[model samples]
Target: MGKLVTVGEAGEAVVLERLLAALAVPASVSGVEAPLLGPGDDAAVVVAPDARVVATTDLLVEGRDFRTDWSSGADVGAKAVAQNLADVAAMGAVPTGLLLTVGAPSDTPLAWLEDLGRGVAAACSVWSTSVIGGDLSGASELLVSITALGDLQGRAPVCRSGARPGDVLALAGSVGRSAAGLALLLAGGPELAEEVAPELLAAHRRPVPPVGAGPAAAAAGATAMLDVSDGLGVDGARLAAASRVHLDVDADWEDQHVLDLLVAARRLGGDDDPWGYGLVRSWVRGGGEDHALLATFPAGVAARGLPEPFVRIGEVLPVRSGWPAVTVNGDDEVVGGWDVYA
Candidate 1:
């Protein structure tokens, strides 16, 4: 890895090639070969194996999506890539390339930017994807926009509208840890040394989405699928509404993991009543940002038939009268999850 040149050391004349070279070298070393043309060209040309493409975009702002006090520049960059790539995965496609854009103030350190590039390269390498091209510009606050492309490989794109009655609701990865981490940070819990809290704190800093589970579910004949970016209650409701079916979730509150988180929450001394069942349930059921995959498979598919890391948690039901989109433990209704406008 090349040593990052700081802004103070580089002076006023910002050479675009120097910055791009710093990024491109690591990308090249990571086995990121351009399908047609990579950086240093007007544009990149990527091959689509199935004559179709799955694309999605997401933006992350400094103050709103992240904070330097809590997260390093590399964490932000990796997270930005992971979220966008997960969207592509949700469509049952293989991630191929990414186009990243960074906007920052003049005072932003070049070293920080270099670390961000390394983060991006690292994430791309994980999925065997490529950072084809991107643009950089000046802005008021640090902003990152990522556009990801994927190949379907002749499989139909899995959507959220295909779930039906009798389908088995399953989850690919764990949840609630990110929200708990956020709560800990907000309550200054990280400042206090503790055993289990650091894991939660790491989750908030960088989430690991189930990048391969989406395609696995699709291959296993998943009827409907979506990533749990928002809270499970909110995103589950959206899936239910889209499929016009109801989800009856029976979260295992007695699970060991849930119990551990509850203990951590209480130790953090947050404003919320961590000991109460309602608050704990809120974190497990309504807390978001984990980016786990919630999918529905056909009824006949047994546990062994499904992919690894996927566990059954609920079932699909007919929309009954006076019932909300999603119900917890057969009675408790979840009205909403995270709301940006709220």
Candidate 2:
């Protein structure tokens, strides 16, 4: 049997060496060339095509951002990378590089750390990019921070402020599954078996955002876009505030987004929602962590004309003085969203 080792036993140099080895992937297989310079360098260099770079970063702290009991090291690693990369794509850019920084206590296991490295490599392998550089630190708990860089390819970067009245409010990817999964975990209903709702549990542990949708939306002339990490209610409001417009989310129950959740709700006995309203609708409105893309397209664009994976969930409206910036319908009731402060 192999002996289990901890970070305290290996020291920083050996630990870093092993982790770097685990992260190494061949360009031939990954279709992603190694960075100009990678780990062990003081700083890594990445080509900024079109002379413009799009960068985004996210900080994940134990307990606050993720729970160790709910996620493995690989799950945490992949989720951190996915969230940051989704942000870069939201700006209408292709991810080109990643930088990972990890802080862990000495008692952490070497195998767990290697799994984290492998997870990062697997996530980055899906694209033509690699982790360029990173730092290690000793801390009381595990912390993961990732910064992802992207290339615009001469295309203008999309921002949240570009949506105007008459634009179509569309969504790419999904909603509520992550929150639903978390709800299931907390509720632990009699029917919460793996066979019943494996997808929901998987959604919470490892969210796979549609990475290409961001750039595709930009190519399709998306006026504004953002990553849906903080639920539609919160992120939609941010977009509305930035664009000084109103968003009316008319989530057709027949829409695919709601339909998919309907199956899940039925699987979990409908009334299992810890949130409110219809279980599926509540999750659809407030679920975050799916890392989906929410974008605005110009008026006159047919819902069918939008690119793959995008569905018209709502429309842009003129800003009202005191009205809520976002409404599920004409009225602003039965709202749901994620709030760190709340």
- Identify the leading candidate in terms of TM-score: 2
**Best lDDT among the predictions, by candidate number:** 2
Tell me model 1's lDDT, rounded to 2 decimals: 0.78
Model 2: runs farther than 4 Å from truth?
1-4, 189-195, 253-256, 262-277, 339-342
TM-score of each: 0.90, 0.92
Off by over 4 Å in 1: 1-19, 25-33, 193-196, 253-257, 269-276
For candidate 2, what is the lDDT?
A: 0.83
lDDT tens digits, residues 1-342, model 1? Answer: 244355445543453554565455454566665657676688988989899999999998888889877788888888888889889888888888888888877778787777787777677777778777888877899898999999888899999999999999988876787888887777665574235578777777778889998888888888998988887888999899999999998756325337757755676544666464555566777777778888999888844567867888889999887788888778888654755656
lDDT accuracy of residue 104 in candidate 1: 76
Model 1 C-alpha RMSD to native: 2.9
Q: Each candidate: what lDDT? A: 0.78, 0.83
